[model samples]
Target: MHAAGLGKQSLLIPKQPLLLLHGLFGFRELGPFVYFHGITEPLKSLGAKVVATRVHPTDSIANRAAQLQTQLSQVLKQYNTDKVHVIAHSMGGLDARYLINKLDWERNIMSLTTLATPHRGSYIADWSVLNIKQKLKIESLFKVLDIPLLAIDQLTPQYINECFNPEITDVPDVQYKSYGAWKQFESKFSYLYYFGQLLAEREGRNDGLVSMDSARWGQSFNEIPNCDHINIINWSESKFDIMPTYQKILSDLYHLEQQRELKWSIR
Candidate 1:
């Protein structure tokens, strides 16, 4: 029998849709941004709609959050649902938090799953500002990520403490989970690399760019080894195995939803 013949509710279990947002210097199409499609596909197969977002490449967190608010508002209106599940990567994680805390979208979301986000500012950002050659290399490689926006000194630790401390009452109703990645398996860079050294010094275990401590914030945390900063979302590498990590996250999120449902049943 055709799916259409089974009726509207036969195969579709409608819940609030999932939204995917990429990191700085990222687009909806880049290699580092493409693997999310795989994760979303599994979700859609489970009867959810996944919406991927594109934002101005150099916009501030505040501006980006405002833009996402508008976009999410439209998604809610279009689907006739008041909430969404957000999955954000890297700087996009900060942007998501901004949407919840700064823009007051706590009531309009269900949960958040952040992947390899630098909740604590990266020392690499600090190092790059001091070394012009490094800055140029980063700008050349990831041109979309504006250095001015990522300046570590300008981005005081206090900023991180204020925004992502989990102490802040940003989204009182939202449940949060974080995924941290580390470059445990062999990678191109070694500890001698400045960023690697920074990672080692600050986090002890890092994803080549961000440390585990930085990525894992709030109460719930998941950790994945053998993945780097970009590999957490990138699809180009065979060695990275980002798919399994995302699959595990999706499974955990599903379990969380089930737990919530059980709680409601008890109520």
Candidate 2:
């Protein structure tokens, strides 16, 4: 699990620092728990300056975006850099998009790489909200608990398709890439396995929650096989090891940085 014996060659010194943004119900560090478990230290060892940001676990994307913008500004200042390459997972991708597009941070972000994010939206969110509305009617209770159902609403197909799609546009200067994970089990024992089957039945291929089609966005896209939503982010409970995938992504970003530098030199 350590990067020292990973056998991967250290990468060239990066031009821009890397910032990791976690997904729904994510935290930077809680005791020994890390949202992006086994990610930051390995990347740092490879000569990439990396930082994982913490945001509201259950707030609306706009609210989280604002918080990320503030945190990113502080990070930029701390590193004495003008821009950063972002690796965002799940809902964090939406927050990053909102920050770049709506918060005027396009120029401050070099590239964005999203992992298993519901770019088009998720049916599960729709189902959850609908079920809650009909059965629990816990809107008031959720508000009192500071649980933002608005965040869940934003992840629904209607919001992403009808509202969010129109409001957000890709910035020309920033490079964008997306990766999706597909759950590959048919076991009823695993809740995520069953959920993946349900989504696959209706949506073709899915990573338990987000469908491959829904997770696809950005200029380039990739599908990672044999992993669920949480697994794609290298969680401890993952069925498969995802450390190599992280290394590959970081390598791609290094290439992107090289390309950008080459273009700048030509100009």
Candidate 3:
């Protein structure tokens, strides 16, 4: 029922592999999803083809989802297949959720693996706004959108209302899993870096963008430590091993492979 040999590899290059997406204000090239060269290559090593989706990272999650849907439609047509799994980061997960829950695409996807996605919004995004230093930075995109800084106090109920939670979105039929990373901010100049690092240090958890409670929106969660939102890609120039996280991610996908077959048969 899983399109025959969903996980098994053969001559045709297997399924459409994984679709990776970037978060808000994040382009295809700058984030860990893209900057880290080995990110997808390692997944490819698992007999899967990887596709990085490009969308206007600054756009609202709704708009981004619409654009990604268009992109995904083309990709599916190109591969001549209807099912593809997703690995999204930060706000990218929000867009992915919209694709499955809002666009009537529940049946088209096999699994969703979110890394540092703010399922409940970010507390740091709120804390940063109060600081005068944060007001004039490129990372202030969210603050700019809210304007007057204090308008929506980081992950406010209103903010969540606007981003998601309209009409009680149902959890889709496919497998879902998440990972989170966190770190502490020691200084202003190092705000992004340190916060990202804290998100990474998760004594028990991260990719540093979203907290454990915020990231795990699926049936199960794959916990990792010492990696921030972008660190998930790679440590830029640092020689840290990101394979462990990828391994956990692959494990989740493997489970989804089985789950998809079961669900397909049920249908």
TM-scores of the candidates are 0.77, 0.93, 0.73
lDDT tens digits, residue span 183-249, model 1: 6534554443456656687668987777898888755898887667766765435444566565565
Off by over 4 Å in 3: 1-16, 30-33, 128-158, 161-163, 166-168, 183-208, 236-238, 262-267
Superposed on all Cα atoms, the candidates' RMSDs to the truth, in angstroms, are: 6.2, 1.9, 6.7
List candidate 2 segments past 4 Å from native: 2-5, 8-13, 236-239
lDDT tens per residue, model 3, 147-214: 33332232333476564657426565767777776544444564266555544453223334467777
Report the alpha-carbon TM-score of model 2 versus the true structure. Answer: 0.93
Say which prediction, candidate 1 or candidate 2, comes out ahead on TM-score.
2
- Candidate 3 lDDT at 181 equals 66
| Clash list (residue pairs), candidate 1 | none
C-alpha lDDT (0 to 100) for residue 216 of candidate 1:
83
Model 1 TM-score? 0.77
Off by over 4 Å in 1: 1-14, 30-38, 41-46, 132-158, 162-170, 185-194, 236-238, 265-267
